[model samples]
Target chain A: MATERTRVMGLFDTEGQTASAIRGLRNDGYTLERVHGPIPSHVVADALALPKSRVGWFTLAGGITGFFCGFLLAAFTATRWHLIVGGKPIVALVPFVIVGFEFTILFAVFGNVLGLISQARLPRFGPVTPYDPRLTGHKFGVLASCETARKNDLFRFLEAKGAEIKADEGGQP
Target chain B: MTETALTYQTVDDTVLATLRPPEKSYWIAVALLFAGILMGAGCWLYQILTGIGVGGQNNPVHWGTYLINFVFWVGIAHSGTLISAILHLFRAGWRNPIARAAETMTVFAVCTAGLYPFVHLGRVWMVYYMLPIPSQRTLWPNFTSPLMFDVVAISTYLTVSSLFWYTGMLPDLAIIRDRAKGTRRKIFAILSLGWTGEFEQWRHYTRGYLFFAALATPLVISVHSVVSWDFALGVVPGWHTTIFAPYFVAGAIHSGLAMVITLMIPLRKIFHYEQIITIGVLEMVAKTIVFTGLIVGFAYGTEVFIAWYSHNIVEMETFRWRAFGDYALEYWIMVVCNTVIPLLFLFKGVRTHLKWLFVISIFVNIGMWYERFVIIIGSVAHDFIPHTWGLYRPSLVEFGIMIGSFCLFFFLFVLFVKHLPSVSMTEIKEALPTGGGHGN
Candidate 1:
């Protein structure tokens, strides 16, 4: 026998109300598969208890790389090229320090950007489920995937929390 | 009707309503800017007809007003990027009202700064020689050269900053589009790019914005550092120093923020953004000015110390000449304007008072321009060889061009304010207190 999964979504009148329903479901140990809200709400993330993001760590790594790259470029230009000038030292460490510092900052900033894009899994271009156009304007929704056997219980729980259940028809809800 | 009045009173919507309408002063500013633009164009034509020789560029003093104005414009440009990108990253709410205006200044200032090197070039038509392209003539730009590095750095900075500015304006443009009636609506609709506040769109838009800001913060630092390297990488006594990069960057920010404050004081009054751009924001920016001023002051001290400690007679004499010799008046003026004026900002009363802050900002800008002049022309005027030393004075053409650059800057800013929303409405609305609680 194979376990079956059922997806249920509850539409609420407001962001605050939908957040409450999500919170209630999460407290009862039902994993929230997704959330579609009128606007961004931190409550959904809090209910899910998502782990700390690694974007900062990635930015830090990029910064370090930038610093080293800057240092190397300056060092190489001044020392390896050996462009002697007026009996002054061929490789002046002092002047080259500026380039090194500049490159370090440049690389670090780029790294942070790259990290943010990749980590966010952004530029998403996938098929989106058709939702009420008005939902985006001023409505909130709670979407969750659960065991097929528990569909009736979940429906009852959501209805009890004042969520309006819309029937799924031909893959459209 | 009485109930509605009671609700309005309870809701505290009066503050928004009480915001003064856009006044006649903005029109006067617009007129002045237009005049400036005309003057600048007239001067530029004069420069073109007579040639670069009309301005003050003699032997040994190869760079003059053009380069000084270039650095000044570039320094002024930094404030916008700093306020927009860096403050956004840090989630500084106070940046909401003025970020757009500041970013626009950055773009126009960069455009004006970009013209200087070409104008300085005796053969302006050979400007393409700076680009890395295969041509009939075998003249490849030296990639290692600091001047070449400046070409790359400035172009990159300009490109990135413009992208950042335009992208940031998109959402606000949409707001303006919806609120606008008739022709303005049509214009804004096109600029808004069909933004409908869709969730997925917002997600991508915000992510892209954040990514650009992150990319821009360091680019700002690098661009100025590269500009400093143009001086620092040389064998000149005053120019060749390790500290020049940071010193120049700090000085740039100091001047840039001062310019921003100077512009904003008048704008806030004219645009009726008194409530939005509060005393708190001005104080915060003033603090940044003071901080950068201290860094600049320290760099000055360090330069003197290094000159004396190195025991290089030429270097020591250069420092002496800058401080106590013929240019002593200029040097002391730089110190008084840059260092002493900023010290008044330490007092809360002065910082909070917009009028005082505005006056001080002017002094700071003047001091910063002198600072660049001191570094570039001062060092060149009194170099290692005594017989080669000479004084540089700008001719009428040079003065006209300098004034023209100011006109160009003001012209762009005025047009930007009239056509576009000077304040970021969406960002400002987002920051407004939701339930009558003061937002920190």
Candidate 2:
């Protein structure tokens, strides 16, 4: 039996304050719905305990694929025509390395970008829930959904930690 | 906002103000650039109707101005990545304000450079032959060819640079989105991909940006090396050299940094971003010029030394002819501009003085263009057989096209400054404190 939960938001002024509130939430076993800020901050990252991104796996996979693809494309195409220059072999392995280098980078870039967008769940349309534009400007923000009965406790919990609680956000009481 | 009063709000207000409705001067600039574009298009069309000879690339000097413009523009595109990606990897804070403009310069410069090869083709319609697609005749492009390497390298450079630029812009676009109204807001909404600065977004975005920087560092170096191979692979006397790769890379960065200074000085004044772009940042860039300039000068001396040291008569003749021949004026201009004048950056007063940096940068720009001109046409003009030796002077068509390319670059640049926040608003805000903060 699940109870309806109230969505509450907290706005913080300083990086120190943001970290403090997030730490308080963790100590009390309250999960943060989201933390938003104007820029990336290590303090907030540490507070959330986010893992190092596995995006490199994507880049590694892409590089490996690109190297083989580039080498094969050169080898297969060169075989189609018995082209040789200055007694150089038709299947010139040395020359093919240049193609491999370029493709490895290109595919790696593609993979990195794809991994970013896919992992971030980006291109999210409409307004982000519990959104505050200032979070994109000066402020740091934290949002949490909790049991309706625990709403006041969460607000008091955030306020005690120096966070300013947003009132009547989108007509929520 | 003054440098003494920097805050998060002012960062947004100052940069986004460029997006305010255009001024009379702005339109005048746009009109002038448009006229230049039209002049170039007319010349290009005339050449198309007339034939490749109209480019005035006579025999022996067949590379001509188009190839010079090709390499020149490609060289200009390099420093942007060096600044945006390399500096980021090194965690240089001074790169903050300038990186946005540098990255944008790369995308457009590459765009401008990419057109030259097609323009050089004489028959631009057959340009698809450069693609790697399966031909109707079953002939694929040569993977072994340096030109094909160029096709791959440059297109990849363009793609990577653009993605890097756009990825960095995501949070800034969201800033614009938050501040806009109605239709403009909707457009930014889509462009921003609904970014709300969530930890998840930042996590992936930062990591991806890191990899983009790491990957782009090598790509930028390789792109120009492939361009150098366009000459180095050939057995032509002056064109064949092991040093061309590093020499060209240094020269490319030299011109690229100069262009950055050339464009940014005026941009800083216009946007009233003295606080954001600060003299310290400019000095940092100028100091880099001293290092790059020294390498360029050393390469010049080393080239002469290498020619004499090798005892290769053909190569020796090429060097001798370049220094004392009919095109000696162009040769000296390259030496002075690319080498001598940039040496001024060795002094702190010159490096910090905006006007000095700007003037010297213009000279470097000229010198770099002549540098390519000297290397490409000068070398070819007097290669193996004296009987085939010939000189090139760009015809009206070539001159018009070159002028148009400059105008095209400036035109795209003007549009970029006007439409987008010329500085990174989010990055600037990251530097803000509870009070006034110093900008990077």
Candidate 3:
């Protein structure tokens, strides 16, 4: 399945050009959203006023959880098993730190992966999203949802603003 | 979002071209790697059937070639994470082209390294006993042992490194997905997790990338340190030392950087990605090798000095034996290859010259292997008990398996380069400013 386009999209060569088009679209009362670039661009993000992603919070939470879990696992298991070696303390804090440190990294990585996939709303197998391949390369792209009545005007607006407009119509969501 | 003739499509076309089906040279290389893997697998099977005795390990020198290779490969794995995560954190632009290949190498090297413990075990099937789980007999692995820490650290490092690598590949995979067709397209689509390069997707990806880099940075230091503890925790004459952690970490990065150059020089040549992986990047990597070589050399000096300074008869004797003992040849070779050769990189000409850099890298690689061997077997072979001491020469089985591990690594790498963008398209594109030269 592929994504149905409910909007008009344009491919621009650079971030500045995309920013200008987005500004022009906003002036014309079109809601500006989803600016795409080959790289993460502060210019494009600023133009669209994107929210800062909260992925870091997930990582922090995962790390804290991992620390406690790792420490407790080592401390608890040793006491539970009661297999004393070399007559050392059952809860060896210094040695347990190693396990804790490792698990912190392990769970933080897991959190990062989960955060990326969930926040990105990934693996949408239903349909291909309305997109341009060049958006991930050198071109900066913009997609603006429009009503059927305003579609022609939107295309003309994009074309007049020097965008290489493409009709992104496809599968049902 | 500005206009240029070099658009996203062009970059995609250029990088994806390298992913095309193999030419004759590629085919030959893959075949050779496959043959090496087959020979190694056969040797492993022979060893498994005939017992661990088929290998070179004996009473005194129990940890021989397999353990050395394990350390060697794990050291080789370090550069990938260092290059990818460390440099990314530092925002070093030269790291763009090198990141993907380096991370891939890390994963494959770790996989190769992980196999040795199993191979070294008397009963490979009993490997599950190493895990910390509830058992009918209530047996639990000792967490206090550095060897146990090694198992946890390496496994955690592997998981984190793989995740970091896979996360970074999504954008590139999306590019491939868009360019491919039919089954290939479907495969990439699934692998890419429906990436559309949408604003939200990129936002999450960038944040997640930063988080992964942060998480991986400490791992680069910790994993090798734990591996070092495997020896440091032991009371063996040469192996017992507090400096082992930092020294091992430094050595890991040193050898890993050399391995990266060793792989990338040939890779860029084969893929004709010279423009992307230019001499500048290679020179930068070479410079890093020089820096790391100095640290390793200092550690070596410190090791010898500590041995003598400690005034312990066994420690002093071990230090003396290292340079003038039965394995004197290997010891000197390690010093010359690891420490002395890397000194040539002090000159700009050596760092810039790919051929010279390549030669130096091969030497560093050999030196590192011998360093581990010298540290491991050298100490074990001549313990405090002269009567029990013995030398270990690897049997053909061990040699074959060692060779096979290298082959397996190359095979995976070769397959990765052919199937995916060897040079990261998104990162290289990101590096270039508006209208900048392609893949610089």
Candidate 4:
């Protein structure tokens, strides 16, 4: 195994405290490895300044692909065998639009799901850092990674912002 | 308690506890549902061995109980999307507790509904011929056929809804993984996709959820409309109406809302989620039921009025037969159960009273099933030619399959509640006072 990276986690009960704590950590040149909360909050997100997710573009791309594919498939199959029933035209736009619309939804949803997994970088191999499970329930947790020499400084930094620090010394429980 | 009063920890503890291994009653229910599934499977196998002739399907009445059950199940699946996706978009706060179960119901109901077309096929093995793929035989299913549209629409609905359900559950599953031990922890770890509630993950997850909801909203409307066109595109007097699309969509949501209520009541009791799935939630669902029931009522009345005004002999005769025909008893019962009984929900008392609401929901489900039956069997039994008019009755085999389908639906739901968080943990926590208001 690689040498363990020192990690210190702080649990805060309020979103405002967590936000200020995150800002404090960032201002001091300490990067926040991760922040966990019971819910997604705009206050926290704004504090962290998260990058915009590109899922909508994925959906748009999937929809366009689906639209043309649906129309072409319908058109191609209609003309493939060339069934001359009552001498009607081979490619009918009106009826085929239904298929196109259904596929738009189908593939757009597919793209959205795929975009989530890819963008979130999901199905990760293991826990990314030391995390408190209570953050998922009612509390806000912030994990800060640093050198063992700077661990004491990080602890004082978190405590000043009204947070309870969990000193997970060796990075592993 | 109002959402504003609860803390995040309280919501987390309450919702996560439901994932525990259920009690003896759950096992007993599972066993019963398993038996029903087995019985259904046995009946299906018997049909396969003997032939499709075992069911009550023949010449003019070839579409029988299987199709009726299919439409009913599909309709029952609609409310999941209605509650989860549509309400989410509209930012309905009360939907927080009920959304998970409703979305789960959507997937399983669609699964149950998807089985019927195969069961109706005389040669079940050759059912794959319906696929658009090419085979050794140069045969391709006609995309123009409504049956083909149904296949694509239903499959898409299933895929998208399942994805939506899985996406919402990721955070909850991670919490379970953290709390669990041994084999259970390992399983949830894999299922949770190593979710850590990292800020980036949350960012992408919310975006994906919104887009999923947007995609699913249209699907909820289109899937049932496609199912309706399976009948509407036909030349049959009653089946060919233009209003059938919206009419079917309304009926689908109405029936689906009833099913959600039916499932939620027992679940809330069993899981001790009374605080979360409060009477207030049930009331909201009940009010929607009344609204949808009125739409369905309007559709019913419109159909009758159109039949009277069209002066088309076939349409007029079919309408007359529906009221006083051989299946008139079912028609009247459908009217009473669907249109009249739902009106009781307009009163706050009946809507909030658990026992009365549960009873009314069951009746609504039965009425909705009967409505499909009346629409399907009634029109086919009495068509354009009086001489060819026929009466159809279901055999024990058909009855077995229908019972089996209900068993299958409940069974999947039971399994879901046992394994996953039945209510959304993240959402409920977001609805708490400490968090922001109803974090839509």
Candidate 5:
């Protein structure tokens, strides 16, 4: 049987505290596994050296797709339909622009939504280990994967930095 | 941590706590809204009791104030979603206190706006004919028609926005549920759908909320564009321009933001959310209104320029009539109110001053409504033949229904602020440096 690796999770009561702890942990060669907070904290992200989110890339793609689709709808309707009335031009680019612009915004927004969902990995119905309910109200938690031998050291460091030890539940098999 | 030392200085709490139930001012506003609703009801009743003749709808001017108000309300609905969803997507922190309230306005305004088409139909019962349903009559709604597009667009917006608004309320409802002691607790508990503030639940809720916001963002743009298409798709003189989509959208945001400021000013004062909805937030929103107003003003200018540059006789004549014809007063008022009044917001003092911003917002709303009225009635009233060119006079019923819509919007908003948590508690708490954990 393989020995299970221990992971350390530190819960802080404040964003500033979590941020500083993250920086200190990073400087000491610890890698952060995940962060759970009530809201996003850029400072914490910066400390953890997380990369620029792919959400923006997804949103941009969505927006571009929406824009083109909108343009096509308008262009096709006005030009291809041959709904000529009086002596007016069969396909007018000017009027089509409005519809095109609208579609651009529409598609871009769709991209943003889709990107967020895919990036966030939402709607997982399987049961997972529960976190402290108080985390919803005010807690900021930092989870770190560590070797079994270094677990005690990480715990001691977090405790010295005013972090409360939370559950040591392992990842789902 | 000392409980007494924590600042409980949010303006909403102070104002709401002190607001006596139904004061003279409250009664006056309510009475006015009720009167407008009743008058509209009377107009609707008369239309049902008799026919659709009471509100002047001649040959050319088939659409009247009912459609104008519908477009106007739909435009009004756009701002709330824009402010809530767009701002949220960008991670604008200031929207925390007012997003939910703004969303509520969006939902109610959309509901009111949705009614105009049915009212315009003399036989309101035939509304089902507009739906994409197969019947014994073997009639199908023309999907090509802009009106059908409106039904789809508006319905989509309403459905998505309602979901967005309700999803946002879930967490807050849970808070209320925990706080309540009696029957209210049970009601909140059920409404909360058994939300337990568990980490996994929040994880899903947040993701779900973000997804909905993203979904709602496009609907905001598409809904209004489709509304604009109702006219732009037509070959009618001034209405046939391509600029109508962006022009209409800009105008919608302009008026919508103005209405938001108008509602928030009174609400903040009434509810005492000064700390939560600070002067800074009001100023920020006012600045956005100014930017949108400027875009709308530019669009207005471009439309006039394009009309002349295109050199199309009918289009040119439409522009001429809009500027110097029968409804010149309405046009000028729109120019002055929508374009000029918002220009005052460029001043730092005006933007920061809540009272001034509030007054400006009201004027902006009034101006935008007139702009729609001018666009719809102006083009429709006068067309290719001078012989068919006529005027539209909105009867008392038309006027009543328009005012009634405003009442409906306000009534829903007022009720929402009182019962529901007006501010996003979780979001606001997150903004605090301490993550709001200091309280415990």
Candidate 6:
């Protein structure tokens, strides 16, 4: 069945009010689109049932790659031209460890950044409609897509939890 | 209102006020800094035209004021990452008010420090030779060189710190975007990359921030250690010591803490951020300085004590020259400024007294610079061979260039506070006793 999903955004003055409203909506089987606020919230995440982030895997992968790259680069350059100073070995890993450590961090940071952009769909262009500027300040915003027929029911439920309805319009799921 | 009483609105208003167009004194200061830059640049040009000899880097004292300035500036860059990254990992709430300022210092100090290598290299254009790129004969830069570690570590430090600083500022930039109008609004919106504070975005952001802090913590310690290795790997009597790594790291953080106190005091007074960056916070920074200061002092004593106890004639002679020779005055100044002076902060009266703290911080800055001078020049000037030893003093050209570096640092900082919110609004808001605290 092709049921319409309309966009709705609600603003709450306090974190307590937003947490409860989101929790209530979730318990009633409504899937939330996203919540916007000035800060991250563990309470809201719990309510939304989001999984743990996968950014660490990316960082770990990048770190391993960075270390190997640093080592190989040094080893390659070192063997390409053999010049021994003070009778020391040309391809020593002890000195390369510093290079490896530096690269490990450098790449980990890069991977972490890439994970953020990819996982979060960042650099989002165009205005995300129904957004209030106050959401960046003290206000907490709850965005959801609801069945067009029950928009009023969602509104009443949110208003019951002390939310200010900022937007109620048709939008894609 | 107290910190707990602060609402998001007041925090935004307070930080945003610092961004407003400034008084005449600001323009005057900016103009003076610009002139100082020009003078420094002019002197650098003079050096380039007249050959490197004008800087007074001679046979024994080949490493002169330029190396000292480089190490000093790099050391200045340390505590910023220590406070921002390490404290974030530890969840020390005290770092909240001043972390933004400190992180900014790291970026600018690195930028300033990066310049000296070029200045020191009379043939500045040959800098690529220091990189890993293959030369005409396809010789890669020797990775075993401590200088190689410096190249990689410092560039890495600059890149990571910049990324960390910007990522933390994203939400705060969004706050400004909403509050702004016209062109400013459009500019901030783009800078913020259209951040709307979605929960998913925040989730990824917080996790990424944790990862950055984690990566940066080790990088900070490693960078200074690498810098110390630049000297430690050498066979110079004073430079080559196993203690050099930890000793340099402690002194770096020590000088860096004093610099934070120096910058933040006037910043608070001028920007009226006393409410946000309270004197209590400054005292906490001072308290940290006490710990780092003691480490620095202990390192100084250990150096001399080890020199005497080791009974290595060269090391012993180096110490004797450092404390009682031609450069003894510089050594005493270093001890007095870095060690004895910071001890004053142990007293509450001195720590809380703004004027006293500022004056002491200035002396510490001077003292730390001289400590570098005493270490580099003192050892190099009077090394093993008696006939090759000679005293080297900095020419006026070197002093001019040094003055320019300081002006460049302050100039960047002054411009920074004006353009961006010196205090992170979102972080401050998160630190409030409100729910949904992200621990930014």
Which runs in model 5 stand beyond 4 Å of their true positions? A1-12, A15-173, B1-35, B434-437
* C-alpha lDDT of all candidate models, in order: 0.72, 0.88, 0.86, 0.87, 0.73, 0.87
Please give, for residues A92-113, the per-residue lDDT of candidate 4 as tens digits: 7766787888889989988898
Per-residue CA lDDT of candidate 4, range B329-386, in tens?
9999899999999999999989999999999999999999999999999989999887
Identify the runs in model 3 with alpha carbons over 4 angstroms from their true place: A1-6, A146-153, A171-173, B1-10, B435-440
For candidate 1, the docking band is: incorrect
The segments of candidate 6 whose C-alpha lies over 4 angstroms from its true place after superposition are: A168-173, B435-440
Model 6: per-residue Cα lDDT over A1-173, one tens digit each: 89988777888877777889888888876768879888786666676667788888888888999999888888888898899888999988799989999999999999999888788787876767777888887788898768888888888888898888887543211
B142, model 5: CA deviation in Å? Answer: 1.4
Interface RMSD of each: 7.8, 4.0, 3.1, 3.7, 6.8, 4.2
Candidate 6 interface RMSD, angstroms, 1 decimal = 4.2
Per-prediction TM-score? 0.76, 0.97, 0.95, 0.95, 0.76, 0.96
- Using Cα atoms, each model's DockQ against the true complex is 0.09, 0.58, 0.53, 0.50, 0.11, 0.58
- Report chain B TM per candidate: 0.92, 0.97, 0.96, 0.97, 0.94, 0.97
Instruction: Write down the DockQ of candidate 3.
Output: 0.53
Comparing candidate 1 with candidate 6, which one achieves the higher DockQ?
Answer: 6
- Cα lDDT tens digits, model 5, A1-173, are 87556767788876678888888787777767667654555556556555544666665686678667655655554453366667766555555554455555555555655664465553333333434444444566777766777888889889887899887663211
lDDT of 1 by residue, B47-147 (tens): 87888778887867878888999998898899898899999999998887678778998999999999888778857788998875667775555445688
Let me know the TM-score candidate 1 reaches against the reference structure.
Answer: 0.76
TM-score for candidate 6, please give it: 0.96
> Taking the tens digit of each residue's C-alpha lDDT, what string does model 2 give over A1-173?
98988877898877677888888887886767889888898878888889898788788788888888888888888888888779988888887999998899989888898888888888788545667667787778888767888999999998887777875354100
| Alpha carbon deviation, residue B406, candidate 4 (Å) | 1.1
Best prediction by DockQ: 2
Give the per-residue lDDT digits (tens) of candidate 3, residues B215-284. 8989889999999999999999999899999999999999999999999999888777766788889999
lDDT (10s digit) by residue, model 6, range B1-440: 65565677778888988888898999999999999999999999998888888898999888898999999988988999988999999998888889999999999999999999999999887888887776786768889899999999999999999999998889988888888888898889889888888888888889989999999999999999999999999999999899999999988898898899899999999898878888888888888888887888999999999999999999999999899999999999999998898889989999999998899988988899998999899988999999999999999999999999999999999999999988988777767775533221
The regions of model 2 sitting more than 4 angstroms off are: A167-173, B1-4, B431-440
Sorted on TM-score, highest at the top, how do the candidates line up? Answer: 2, 6, 4, 3, 5, 1
